[model samples]
Target: MKTRIFQLLPISAAVACLGFAGQANADQTVRIGHVAPLTGGIAHLGKDNENGARLAVEEINKKGLTINGQKVTLVLDAQDDAADPRQATQVAQKLVDDKVVAVVGHLNSGTTIPASKIYSDAGILQISPSATNPAYTEQGFKTAYRVVATDAQQGPALALYAANTVKAKSVAIVDDATAYGKGLADEFEKKAKSLGLKVLSHDATNDKAVDFRAILTKIKNERPDVIMYGGMDATGGPFAKQARQLALRAKILSGDGVCTEKLSDLAGDATDNVVCSQAGQALEKMPGGADFQKRYTARFNQPIQIYSPFTYDAVYIIVDAMKRANSTDPKKVVAAMPATDYKGVIGETTFDSKGDLKKPVISLYNYKSGKKALLDVVTM
Candidate 1:
């Protein structure tokens, strides 16, 4: 009788172990990749984007996730591309190899454009929170999508503001020579010309360039009414500062890349001479902007830079697709993205055939007393 009882105990123990194993198998971890320039001149902006995604991941996990009736945990696999195109591709490949279900970023157009191919090849959905280059979506990569308006929309808006609002008849164009900068400059130049604004001169400067005196001197000589700089704040700020120091009274107009809260510090008092366009609505105007700002500040102990709200929405958008697809598989998620109509912190987001926002908003900003002031919001 004792031997029979011991045999039954062993069988019961085996059944308990099988139950534990089955429960473990029912729980799955879904990896989502987020890439940005975490260690560079624009690292602050990159960190902001990453923090937004991280915050969303934490919130989603806390709320609990279930896909196909199985419990799931979301993990954010953040990577740094340093805003470099080459490094971005490398990071993209690594994420692909790591089998991330989807990706949230590659902030700069230069990096996003190059890295997008890798994501496309891997059949993973890639959403850019801040990359505004129109080419990012025009590449025919079904995997590429952006939460922000494209440069196509932003450039013309900036050009229209420069021509009508600033009352500028002539403008000089300068680009950082990267995919984002050059593309935006080109679009602005085309629209500026169509609007009957004379293009005084167009020049190219590398993204890493700090000394814009040579170019500014050349532009100053031309004496255009507005100096349109298509670059990030890292270069645009100093460019405006030097232009002011050189006594160039022309207002500096730029795209979303130069539109940030940190621009005030980088450009100092000269920020007043700058007018920039953002590819999204102003934070105050967003549906959940105020609450998001409060939560983001509390979590990161820092102010939102530019694209954090968009990044936050990007993560939610991805999860929304996953839920609709009822699968964490990248291919299934991509299939569900086209039907996305999720309302998030940034607002209602829907994609066109090209994966660009169906209805996009562009906001114009200027600095007054070293503070960013919203000038106008344009919808297209």
Candidate 2:
């Protein structure tokens, strides 16, 4: 009986050793959610944001990081919101339910605002790469953070630039009627009027609308020196293209939403007439801009869009918080995030009390021969 018992114990010990070895070799996946408009008019920009996050995840996994004394692998839970607020909320909840440690998107302000509540309720960290509405961070949600300046800053800067540099006497405004569009347009109008420039007209259009002939014709009658648009490049580009087709000579001005490489292709021959603003420093000015562009292009086989660098930085910021907390738990990461001060591809990043970036910088840009040219940087 003793010999039989010894034989059984050896078999059990062999099985246990195999199990332990397998567990040691396996990596625990830590999911990080990424929400964006991956299947709509602005899908190109949305995909660009996702690609940035994915690149970071892939690189981090390659390094074989161990957090909490366990080999951990980062995973991306990418959800498509189609740039719709309702869809954004749905996906936000889904990501929360999926137990993502942090969220890095919902690119449009309209979507980001609604989705932020879901993340806050779940106590997950959310760092938007492109949503610039002031209301997003002003709501006192501890979980909310953004890498870009708010519309409160971007709108006035563009308006001031138009007043001082463009020397515009009158400006016509058009918005896509989304939260981001109307909000930015309203801010621009306030500053433009304060600067003593006449606002000839302010028109609203749906984002899905492609024809701007009616509005352009009416705007031409006003004969403004500048036409400012508050919307994404998906709509803003066509708006400029149509404005040029109607033979309007007014220069086109817009906020960060319309500032992207895709704008030139979307606007085609009319690209040179458009000048836009971005919420951060120009790429040339960012510490990691050149290396980031090289790596991003190599990974995605595409040029970096306006918000890619921001999203990339956002991913790294979340990881920074996770490492600081020494855990992949969402609550721990959120708690560590308020103190984040990471130097990233965009520049130095530090969030204020309201989750808004401190010392925000804005860059003015124009397109020439299908290339985006930097004009100036305004720091605040």
Candidate 3:
């Protein structure tokens, strides 16, 4: 009996030791929020952004992330705002309730601007991958940050290209009436006038408008050398298609919203007549773009849209801040964000006082044979 008791004691000790080892290496789950219009007309773009974040989260876990000496498992709590301002606010509140340490998303300027206040009030960090409205950062919300350049820069870059490269003497402007569309069109108009381009006419169309013949017919009669559209491809593509159907031969100039890999499908052969500017460096020119593209395609079996690289970098940026702060606490992570100098798939990213990128690059593109081709890259 004594020998049997001794043997059982040793087994019990070994079991206790194994339990302690397991506890020591236990993973602490951390929640990160991603909000985008996942169910709307631009769902593809939102899914692209979510895929980037998910890939980062997966990679981080696979590579072993230790935050403040504890192994951490990142969980992405992705939400859909449906590209509506009211829905955006609701989604923001939901993420806040979910207690995410940081957020990456709200892709549209209209949605992002409304959602930022919720994140700011909750003291959470909100990093936008593609919101280009200057007002997004101008709102004075310390919590708001965007990886891409603002309409203030993108609009002028497109205008300069139209006035100099396209050599357009007169231009007509059109907007989808959303914050991003109108704001970009406004900025483009300001730069176009300063560059001595005649203003033919400016028109407003709702984002959901399908038939643009009335507006396109009016602009066709104006006979402008160029037509600048400030909206997403959903509307802009059809707008361009209708313009061509009306025999309007003017080159269509647009901002990033209308520039997409899917635009050719929407605009058909009229895509050849469209020239657009993206608010960042082209993917092929990004520092880690090629490698990222290969990995992303392998994981998702799909092509990237405009903002996936930015979203991918945004996730890394959030994790970087967590490492710097040594805590997954939202406030602590946010406090560490201002000093960030991390280089990722989108190249180097540094923020200014307004949470805007200190240096931004804009890329111009045009479609040929239903494919987007990079024309030039502008640094600002």
Candidate 4:
């Protein structure tokens, strides 16, 4: 009788283990997708943003969250949009088809703006860390939002600086023809003209173009006191280099798009004295920048870039929203977003009625020793 009981106990334990395994296989997990230009001209910046999102998931899941009375695991699904709007559509569709609970990004404003429509229709929440185009949220898409202030705000801030600080009387505008590029160029043009500055010339360039001898030559003749580039580093770098080669010699200014190490690589010595506006001041200057920077460097084995702090904050914002809504339902998560003052790595972040960041600060930087460092902090 004893021997028979022992053999039965072993079989019972095996059955219990199999049942647990089956339940685990059927367990529901919360998944989020991140879309970026992982393989193209902006791949490095994309990778930085993607890593930030992934780090957020890793830290959140390690805490072992429970939603709806069940254990929840946060999973990250990465997709490459190649910084193209058409490809952004493909990547966004893939995320929706995969049924992720939310999405963290489509980095560029051009890609983010179009892909947002798809996410809006599908009822998926998207929070962009770096897409600053005004039209991104102006379309009245309830599910689309960004953590950084728009180019509409930062563009004019730079224009004011050009007129008031630099005392410039003439300015030239250039754009790469993307949504982010054109919108900012327009804003600067409007404000620069209002400030009684002469508009030297406006020209368009393709993102793939590496040569800008023609554009620089035209600007040289016009002789603007300053040149404002509304484009990313890929073209901005070469334009800076070519401008120097052509002896245009105008002071160059760019937006957050050109705030990267790649600008130095592109322009080499020509990157000197160039200025741009990015989201926040150096980590050492912010209230908690020091601690966050330490952790980021320890984890990633490198210094943080422009959008990583925003992306890091984006993760916590979503997590906090999920907790507040008491659910991971996309609609509920979004509804809770604007009401919360999310204290993220960048500082206390709050959204306005338009789902845009309200009066967030912008920091100015110039190239020093081939790196971008804080010059001044501007409130916008």
Candidate 5:
């Protein structure tokens, strides 16, 4: 089957079509699919990412993008994968069937990894804003790309902080057992042991599990100085809350999954004990960070959450490839990704041979007064 440079508009673009009513009909509707868990426990973060992509699409459409001498209206074809691998592939297949030129997510690495194969087979471009698993881009798939630093980098930085700054002699680890969770925890564990921290225990939990009393009780008995969780905010938040209820004094440490604005609400008063790392610089520290935050809040009526800045930059990165190719075809845009060096809200955006961002920064953060506060930054 021959793919078109612009496919038929999907129902996801129905709202975008409404904006075309008063304006001249667009010469072509360029659809970009976005998939994330919009209906699950981490919906807030997923919705934030979607909103960022929507903001970029809306802005691009307003300015009217031109490619190959044709004015194109960018249409956002958003889908919900519920952060499940099975649903991720289904969503990926749907986007492929809809013939979108590219995709913006599958926020979880578990989802992103499986969905990437589908995109690769279809020759479509995929740029994840938050998926940090090194295996994602390591699968030798040209379609796989991520703007954030990988677990390989994030894990060592977090472990260094725990062993040096926090000065923890012993630590207990818990993971949700998903690809992202296990991979990150394993990396941390490896580095932590090398730093001479005693590994008290290692436990496993489910990503969907809210009650962590069993794991928390077991961890408490171990008397570790630090309790690190490898999972998203959904479970990580509740895990901290339950640990507090159990009177566990060990500080809670986690990777990017558990780091977000929503963690404070979910963890309640327990949020103060949590320290987490994000794969990039804090939004306020980015190049156009302040201005982007102002505009995002004005448009969304809320503060920016995790991945919004990266997703916003991801959209621009995709557009940059399109402009360089002078075409909206996924093949051409994908072929042009390697040569990209676009500057956007994030600092200089460039990718390595493996499709991972070059010169990525890891920003560690802690919550203070029910808000995420920057703790430190390490560039890799």
Candidate 6:
């Protein structure tokens, strides 16, 4: 049998000996879990998330970290949740079964929120780099965390920019009806009302629905200055297109959910003058953003999105916590996480008592020529 031989020495002398073989074996494996919609409606987002997480692991292992005095290698356990909550739950349970000490994923709040409870129950630390629903952390789960600011933050900022900067006197609110979409819509409506902007209409649409002609017609009649959408690019794109088709002259405003190159493709000519407030700034804003974008483009042969940088930060947080705790034991790393304040690619990251990021930044952007250009930094 292959045996880990430190040195053939007396039992008393072996106390000082290093078990080289066992160290090598143990050092070559550090498992982390990720769940995202790898092959569903939001596959583009999932692909970006998985690639970002993978890149972080690559960078970490390249640095050659030592844990418990043994060289550590990162191993990812990825699952396709398909942007479905039930599937996300299954994946979370699977990760717990596999005994992953940490996880970074479930891009959508709908999926992340449900899966988070499972991770909390299992004592696994879960950090969502993109899920922004305020309720995700409000569940009082000690193990749940997010790198992005909540929708509550993004919603008000977007509404304020619309009423103040965009000079809108009246606005219409539309949501995809999911937890993420509806929550953002509610916050935006509340803020817009407080800002003295008349709410022309509030509507809900299924994510899979493409025909928004009926709703667009009503919005056109209301003559709102802007129509704000609380949903991802998948639905936001169609809404923009239908608005233009129905000759609705209202300017479009959306939250981070609609901030993607895919939105322009979905909006086509309707993309012009569309404003959005994202969780963070553009690639140029991050200290490492330019380099990361260059490397990410080189590796993936495509442009990166807003959430990827946060996901990169999430992976590093896990690694840093492991190093601080000096062990991969889930409990130790979890305890050490609060003390972590690492300068990651996404900027200075630190969490609050509720596991939400503290002082997270938001940025406004205007979509032009199939790309989102940063307009201004929106502060709390």
User: Which candidate leads in lDDT?
Assistant: 1
Over 4 Å off, model 5: 1-26
The CA lDDT at 318 in model 6 is: 95
Q: What does each candidate score in C-alpha RMSD?
A: 2.2, 2.4, 3.3, 4.0, 8.6, 4.0
Where is the poorest 10-residue window by lDDT in model 6?
1-10
Model 1 weakest lDDT span, ten residues long: 20-29
- Please identify which of the two predictions, 1 or 6, would achieve the higher lDDT against the true structure: 1
- Residue-level error in angstroms, candidate 4, position 52: 0.8
Question: How many Å off is the CA of 52 in candidate 2?
Answer: 0.6
lDDT of 1 by residue, 248-316 (tens): 999899998889999989889999899999999999999999999999999999999999999899999
- Worst 10-residue lDDT window for candidate 4 reads 279-288
Candidate 2, which segments miss by more than 4 Å at Cα? 1-26
lDDT of each: 0.94, 0.91, 0.93, 0.85, 0.91, 0.85
Where does model 4 exceed 4 Å of error?
A: 1-27
What number of backbone clashes does candidate 5 have, counting pairs of residues 3 or more apart or in separate chains? Answer: 0
lDDT of 1 at 306: 94
The TM-score-based order of candidates, best leading, equals: 1, 3, 2, 6, 5, 4
Q: Write the per-residue lDDT of candidate 2 for residues 1-380, one digit (tens) a residue.
A: 99999899989999999999888767788999999998978899899999999988888888877887778888999999999999999999999889899999989999999999899998999999999889999889999999999889999998999899999999999999999999999989999999999999999998898989999999999999999999999889899999999999999999888899988888997989999999888988899999999999999899888788888889889989988999888999999987999998999999888999888999999998989999999996
Give candidate 2's error at residue 374 in angstroms. Answer: 0.3
**Best candidate (score: TM-score):** 1
Better of 2 and 4 by lDDT: 2
> Alpha-carbon error at 210 in model 4, in Å?
0.2
The regions of model 6 sitting more than 4 angstroms off are 1-25
Q: What TM-score does candidate 3 reach?
A: 0.94
Clash pairs of candidate 6? none
What's the TM-score of each model vs. the native?
0.95, 0.94, 0.94, 0.91, 0.92, 0.93
